[model samples]
Target: MADTLRHYGPAAVAWVLLAYRVSKGRRGAPDPARDTVWLVLLGLSLSLTLLTPAVYAFTGRVSGVPNLARLLGHGSMLVVAWSARTFLWHLNHPITEVQPRTRLHLGFLAATFAAMSVLFVLADTPVDDARFAARYAGDPWVLEYWLVYIAYLTPAFASMAVLGWAYAHMSTAPLLRVGLRLVAIGAFLAIGYNLHKALVFASERFGFSYPPAGHLLIDGVLPMLAHLLVLIGATLPAWGRLVNAPESLAWLSRYRTYQALRPLWRALYAASPHIALTPASPALVELVTVRDLNLRLYRRVIEIRDGRLALMPYLDLDTATAARARAAQAGLSGQALDAAAEAAALHAALHAKALGATAVFGPASHTPGGGDLDSDTVFLRDVARAFHRLERQSHHG
Candidate 1:
């Protein structure tokens, strides 16, 4: 089960991220070419996962090529290496100027892929045996095939280690630095994995016996752990914004509070347009700063309180008492009762004010105010909801 999870977990994550990118369209990447490379990496990882023992068994039977899974895995790894290297190159270099060495790197990758393909085709190995790497370790053809695979892989992993480490230190952004550091670490782990596999096969060919415990750690555990780290590192920049700036989430909440308060504000603003001190811009676009959002929301809360204070002069104690009784009968309690009673009072006051009712002098009760802005926002939102419900109920009556 652990092995299955190790094999499939990264694959599942890769495909999900790929689907998310595709659905989001251009939002996923600033550069289309670079985005395409990332997508290809995701696709290759997903494909390699599906080409595992269970699925490949069926595929092999249908294709009449017993050792087809090895070829598929090799091909997928090659593509992933190419894509990752290209991605890093683009990331490191300025977007305006294409790197001169890019074409040469592409040629090298293409040559590597071609050579691996040729060797796999030429090599004779068992068709149905899933343990192709271990079973054919001593075979001359298998050794050549392994060498071809590792030759490109070793260099690719090493380059990633160097590039990732250098860029991580050079980067100013906290999230980017951390992500690149992870990538560097993962790349080194991958290098270790490749080296271990090479040594295992070489030992078998050279009649040198090595400990099984060390082999298991190098071959079995390392690859899965390395791939998981690499995937996380590669995708970290995309998600780091959410992780780094918790204030962004707070801003979002404030914006939502502003929206929820809209109906109440509009009603109050209609009654007292002078209450608005500042010109309102698009809440989402203009309120980019946390301070701005907080200020805007604060002004809105003040304006609402002012409107409530103004309406209080026209509030009749008899009407409030009757409404409170009716609300109680309607199953309102605590905050809900307070909100309902206030809504009823406000609706009556607005109507009475429209008809110019004489000001009534009575003992005044204050709006609940003790908690921070978040609590205030929630309380006011409930009041607004109750206000709307009262208006709807009155209209239908």
Candidate 2:
């Protein structure tokens, strides 16, 4: 169980990251097909990682089917090699590049996989041997299997390492450079995995016992460590960006709200600057600090509401109803429609106040839109958008 966890835990993490990257949808990235190919590579790596334990437990049943797990594992690795080759080619070249060479590479890999599958089915082997690779080391078909499989994977990882290092050197973006460097490092480690396998094959062919250190580290440690590093490297860019995005976006959103509410706040403060509990600074400076911006926005909303209160008697309901109808006709609805109505009401009230019109009703006669400070700021942004139109219409009447 511990061995299974050690091997498959990062595979599960790789699967999760693959799902998230897929969900985010690619836009503006170079070579969208490369993205899909890399996804397939990781997905197959994860599937094969998961199958390790199952293959161990059911070696008899698996070997009975000419060792279906081993055959599928080889096929999976071949597909990964093909995918990596295509992705690396796409990464380095433009869309105008000829694809025949790419197709040939994939076709050759598929052919190899097909030949190996046929060989595995035909080869005689002990059905109950749990350690198939070591137990069948003397078999010619099995020896060819190891050689051909590694022949494909060794160069694939070596090319990936080379491409990753080259791209890392060329890239100016900090995060991209970091991601590429990690990929190169991980791929470099994976080369050792292939090398260890080659050494195992040499030991079997030449009839020399592998060193105890090689037996322990190569078979038990190298592949898991290599896979974990590769998974981490693959996920690093998305993980870093997603970690930083929300705070950055939130700060930008608050500042945009502060700016959007500016027109209405400025107009109301001009009419009734004395209504503010504290003397205010210039709008630009007030909006710079995120912590202070919330308070500043709240104050602006309150002062605008106060100024409206002082000019309530001058508000003509008939004119407001007509203005709302016009705004609705112009496609404003929901809170935006209400906001336009509020703007129209306030514009009429401000004009009447300027002409020294007296109050006709008490505060008890007024109706308020039931809203708190946050919703008020949002509503007021829409009101600000409609303010100029409301002013023009009121003057025309």
Candidate 3:
């Protein structure tokens, strides 16, 4: 397991770094919480990477991993576990505009995770001490036995149930829905394996030993495989939408929620006629102030990161058409993309109409395929986030 995870440690590290870059650089969300997660994950990655070799050299087995390796691994696991617990707690006990019942459900998840974390620690105590065994009983003062079971098992089962319901109600994007289902199935398999292992362990303590076939489980296999599935599935939404998609699916590709709620802001303005009274025409909509947009609203914001992916808006109509040809040839071939763009133009037009404005324009109108993907300018995303805040406030207030 240690040797096998060598590449994975680096991969995990890369994921954390890449996620941070994407979040801060692309998404422009300078959240310290996100940074902390990144740093901690990175720390784990390094610790794992370094310790794998050290423990391998010291003991040939992880049963007595070196103190440095043990400390690093334990520290990493503790932080990661704590983070998971906190996340669940926050999820269950939302302090914001969350519903009471929903909050209660989240709180249950939090409590469940806390219980699991305790067991996980206790079960794992003296982990590097080969003498330490699940034998006799897990230490008393700390939660032992089934508490860990409750902690680990419940969330897995709960997630499965929740995702099952979501899959039932969800529509269209089969890949994404299927991805979610697979994830749930994977969870079920992992939990089932752990439960079986716990049973085996319990039976051993009680002197009713059965041949431990823990390896017969998907538990050991699922971590790697499930990780792969999550990688493929989670990216399905992004990859299918904007990352590398045909124009037809591109609109459906990214920030669907932002797109849906954006019109409501315009609606708010129309519903209150007095808000537009200062305008030459009460029907005219001004979606944003001039300061909100860069001086070049009509100019494309194109940038490329990591060399291959284009991440900028196209500068001109001709460039957009050219981009479509290039994109289609590169396997992004699609019906919607053939028309290339007019969606952005149409969106601007609709938003204008919604705001009772005669004209509205977006830089996307002048480009092709909603601006070339050759560069990564998340400016459009920034604008969406800006408006998303307003939309949230308007809805909540």
Off by over 4 Å in 3: 6-102, 109-124, 127-146, 161-165, 211-219, 240-397
How well is each residue in 64-175 modelled by candidate 1, as lDDT tens digits?
Answer: 8877776777777766776666667777677555455556766777887788778777777755676666787777766677788888878887887888788877876656
lDDT of 3 by residue, 1-397 (tens): 6645643544464365446445644345553323333443443454444345444245524445323343344334334333322322332344353345334645654565565555554443443442222333434423244544436445634554365336524635555555456545544554555465555455655557653665443434544453344334333433454444444443343334223323432333343333332332221233232232332222222211110011122223454456557657767544344433323322333344555564323254423233443122333433334334444565698
Every model's TM-score = 0.57, 0.55, 0.38
Each prediction's RMSD to truth: 18.8, 18.7, 19.1
Off by over 4 Å in 2: 28-30, 41-43, 55-66, 128-130, 212-214, 244-397
Error of 3 at 230 (Å): 3.2
Name the better of 1 and 2 by TM-score.
1
In candidate 1, position 309 carries an lDDT of 80
Winner on TM-score between 2 and 3 is: 2
lDDT of each: 0.72, 0.68, 0.41
Instruction: TM-score winner between 1 and 3, please give it.
Output: 1
Instruction: Name the better of 1 and 2 by lDDT.
Output: 1
Q: After superposition, how far is residue 252 of candidate 2 from its true place, in Å?
A: 26
* Model 2 C-alpha lDDT versus the unseen true structure: 0.68
